[model samples]
Target: MTLTAAQTVAALATIAGSDNVVGDPAKMGAWLYEPRKRFHQSAAAVVTPPTVEAVQAVLRWANENGTGIIAQGGNTGLVGAQVPLSGNEVILSLARLDRIRSIDTAAGVMTAEAGVILENAHKAAEAEGSMFPLWLASQGSARIGGVLSSNAGGVNVLAYGNARELTMGVEAVLADGRLYRGLNALKKDNTGYDLKDLLVGAEGTLGIITAASLKIYPLPEDYETALVNIASPEAALELFQLMRQRAGARLNAFELIPWIGLDIQMRHGMLDRDPTASASPWYALIELSRMAGTAPGALQSSLEAAFDAALISDATIAESLADRTRMWAFREQMSECQSREGASIKHDVSVPIAAVPALIGQGVTAAETLVPGIRPVPFGHMGDGNIHFNFSMPVGADPKAFMAEFDEAVHAVIYDVVLKLGGSVSAEHGIGQLKVDLLRQVKDPVALDMMRAIKTALDPKGILNPGKMLRSVP
Candidate 1:
């Protein structure tokens, strides 16, 4: 039989002392609330394990009792993965496991606990004269565990790669409470199946990550940042090709933004001043890293070539630190500025780099066709072809009414375009509670069966993050 809520809380408290378990709903606000405010179910209790052994003990108890356990990091995920789905699960918050176990610059790896904040990891790497390049908007609060669990990709992915690429190894507690010590600083280990890759993006359905050895790189001397105006997505794509040809690995970021983003931010006072060169239909925020021995005029020379080719109309290159910060601030605030316009339906989807322009064009057409007055605000990592396809409600429309009427319909239309373009429904964000049904509908049948088989093999009791990435097997 299933345990009662009180019994679950008491069991968790026994595993991780009374001081570490919070059973009161009032005190569970921090763990209950997610970034999107979409998942609001309260957990039976929130457990903060003080040590790796404590995490193992808690998992062992939960597995034996058949209680659900949801592993959470900083609670900053856009999806509902970190929050409770059933309200009876115990939230395993890794907040107490915060630590920087080691940073070996020569070895080019840093070992960080799951609870260590992303920004703190960045600072630690910088202090050691190296860098961890996985930068997201929620770096201040997003923890290493959740970041790896979701396999997050941010602006710098063009140069470095996503969380999965940056992670060298992981240490996790399995569903049955056995510890998998996979941490290593080696450049290669073709020992067997890559278990680290499996747990990194499993969304806590497979295991609870405790710590990881992340790849670090030598810090670049400086960055050449600019915001350039382009005529359309096609023009932006051509200019991106030019950048890649010229800068190669030094090309750090190439983000695309629509005019609607600029209008929304300016109207809402989200930016102190305009970061672009002039008003245009679209913008490409580009940046290139300048190493100590490398020259700084590469970006300027490339922009001149782009200008000659008519790929870009105008541009504003950052001449100072403040200018660079303002440029990035505009790019980073794209998601937040949408709220100023009212209700918005959003998709974090990706296509091949060459198909980004077509995806945006077709997606915008579909969205506008579905909702006559819906405003398209498609933008994001253009180099990687991951666009944050969003649509603002018609002018003066009721946010509740708009969402109720068109949320699902809009998703269908946009996802249709994405799939047709050989793209994925989710790009950077992982499938949590939000995309469970969608994944079932769109994912390949054979692939789904394989996923289920692996999930069953790893977590037979369906205890770790039940009903998350994949639905619980009936």
Candidate 2:
């Protein structure tokens, strides 16, 4: 705490106008509280810089004063990375810097500011007959800076790749307020150290990303979508290999959903109708992009082949836009629909794509062993092997008590299996304040040291997102 609370607010007001500074704790809730409601911490103040120059000025002041700053975007992050870990830090909101700098459809690139909402970026690309393929449930609210900062992976990673891959370059503010103007549409520049990659996924520990040049693809002519029935993850893995063999890069998304997800969504009316051929133990929401002048029914033909080989039991290919949207709605609502059932312990984890079945089977068995009658609701990007492995509490157990007793235990059980299968404990979500200790425990000793060295070299004063990603330098 280099500055007093009042001093910090007053100094920030001077740097980024009083109107841009929020000193009142009552008004800080919007910036302080996260989506998951797990982190509850107060900030010294909240400041929204309207321009990149203002952001640089604020950073300069914070660095000089030795005050901590947490760079925040839409605040829709599941992990607590954007929120304050200590009460002394100020929340630096980039919401006011939203803008689309430029778009070159021919070049397949769009330059967007940090505060530009992802959905708006999508619209910008689409207006130019292009598409940015990084899709997330929080796209409507998540900002470009935060998305790249987390290196978020969505269902489309099987086709287009994650945020890191979609990004060509980034414009960031280093710890000392130096403008790193690395934004470029270059597909190849093997000159020296790739600094753009360094800051993209550092989670604000290394630098604050202000804007980025994101990759965009030509707008597809149409899409082939379907919902297929599978007996288990093993069968789903086999089907995925077949789809890869058939469709290659055009296979946009292959999502696996268990029977429990359908039951919960239906019991709560999350969908208008079942989006499957018939009742089955599991389902895969498959989609393939149809480019201009290409034929449709690729998904149908592939499914037919799968059926002839007995890889799938039954399937229903979407015939209309309404059906396609409904099927997607079913897949996207997997996380939200769990609330209707009960408290569920969740883990965002990933393993080798080849180990998806082993990861699921062992994880479910371990969870059930820990707590009898626990309902396992594991589902996600099966193609990428990052499953949102979650478990609903026993039917009649007390919600608070269930979470209180099983949250950490369930995490341990699931992570053990994930690690054994060569998986990551934090897959899509960055190692925010929530997973600092876990990261310390599981990350390789040398890799952790390298991360700390990078953090120290960039943020010597530890003023940027202090106590996040890497807790301490030593």
Candidate 3:
């Protein structure tokens, strides 16, 4: 009953017009090219459904034909979730379904279709005198469906929660082509079996998210921004606690960056000028959101108290909008600046707040032991205990050889420490094709069984995003 690639394309074109189906590899660059360029297999065809009913119809046909379908949005995902795994799968993109259903400022909720860009959603919320707090560097291209499916976490997670907490309900097409309409603006609902929660972070395995009802917040009047100089991660941790006590929910961001980040930026001439005060071994970028009536200087007062407590050595408060922009650019550009140095190994992991220092300490030591002279660049949401633990290769090592030799073993060493500290291996980024085997090795057996059961109950034919987030090959 297996159809050839040509037959698959023809059938898909029949469901959604011929122009909507892309079988030619040359014209499929946008859908095939992922952020990391990790998963490069060819899809059977890329189908763009223009309407909700069309999406349902395509899914119904694919399910009956036993064709693997991968739900993709924006194609800006880091873990290859939006691209193809097996060559036989067809990619169903929600790009043409872009629409904002409704926005209610009083209710503090907005229902947007899946293909709507994250940045567009922000503008819609702002137009209504509110804010959608899920801000990411890739927001310009990332779509709401991909963000919710990954359950993305970004810079402002300290104040607002991740995508799962921000989203109230979702409307998706289940594996059997049935629509599950769970959209509502209520803050509290105690229904049987939390299906909305199940599909949010499922990475397109259970179903295809078409639209969502998301929470919104009042726009802050301004932000109190500053860059504090700390001697080490331990001091940064202490300063973080002090800021939490002073600002509480208003503390929007607390990001940790080592001095190496500044060095790379300066050498590459990426910045017009240095954004910090002189130079220091470590820095923490902190910001406090000011409400409509609240006065400024809250972050300044908090820093003064930290200085008095010897938690911080020096700090620079942003006096103007330009200063604030420069400070944020410095923190937000950490990931990109790494490429200027050379090849690097990266891990997006999290641990308990108190165990962060230990995690970084052990991770650096272990990596250096394996690859001598590997420079560690550990930075990210310090308050959230999520660190982007990355290590640049030695000065003269070849990138390909280094990755080929040390990638697997290095992961083993770092993950061992993370698991010991009761942390998650994949924090903000979901497990796409990247960590399927690792999840099998590291995840709890009971949790794995539950996930498999749920996957089976929903996608009995395994036609929805097959071989994603699960150890199917094993």
Q: Could you say which candidate leads in lDDT? A: 1
What lDDT tens digits, residue by residue, belong to model 1 across residues 1-474? 988878887888887899999989999999999978988998888999999999999999999989899999999888799999988899999988899999999999999999999999999999989999999999999999999999999999999999999999999999999999999998979899999999988999999999999999999999999999999999999999999998999999999999989999999999999999999999999999998998789999999999999999999999999999999999999999988889999999999999999998998898888899999999999999999999999999999999999999999999999999999999989999999999998999999998999899999999999999898764
Q: How many clashes in candidate 3?
A: 0
Better of 2 and 3 by lDDT: 2
**lDDT (10s digit) by residue, model 2, range 1-474:** 468889999998998999999999998988888987999899999999998888999999999999899999899888899999878899999999899999999899999999999999999999999999988988999999999999999989999999999999999998899999999999989999999989988888888999999999999999999999999999999999999999999999999999999999999989999888899999999999999999888898999999998999999989999999999999999999988887989999999999999998999899999999999999999999999999999998999999999999999999999999999998899898999999999999999999888888989999999999898866
TM-score of 2: 0.99
lDDT of 3: 0.91
Candidate 3 lDDT by residue in tens digits, 1-474? 998889988998988999889998788889988977778988889999998888898999989999999999999888878888878899999998789899999999999999999999999999999999998989999999999999999999999989999999999998778999999998878878778899999999999999999999999999999998999899988889999999999999999999999999989988889999868999999999999988888998898899999988888889999999999889888999988877888998999988999999999999999989899999999989999999888889899998899988888999999999999999999899898888889899999998998898888888888888984622
lDDT of each: 0.94, 0.92, 0.91
Ranking the candidates on TM-score from highest down gives 1, 2, 3
RMSD of 3: 1.1
lDDT (Cα) of model 1: 0.94
CA RMSD of each candidate after superposition? 0.8, 0.9, 1.1
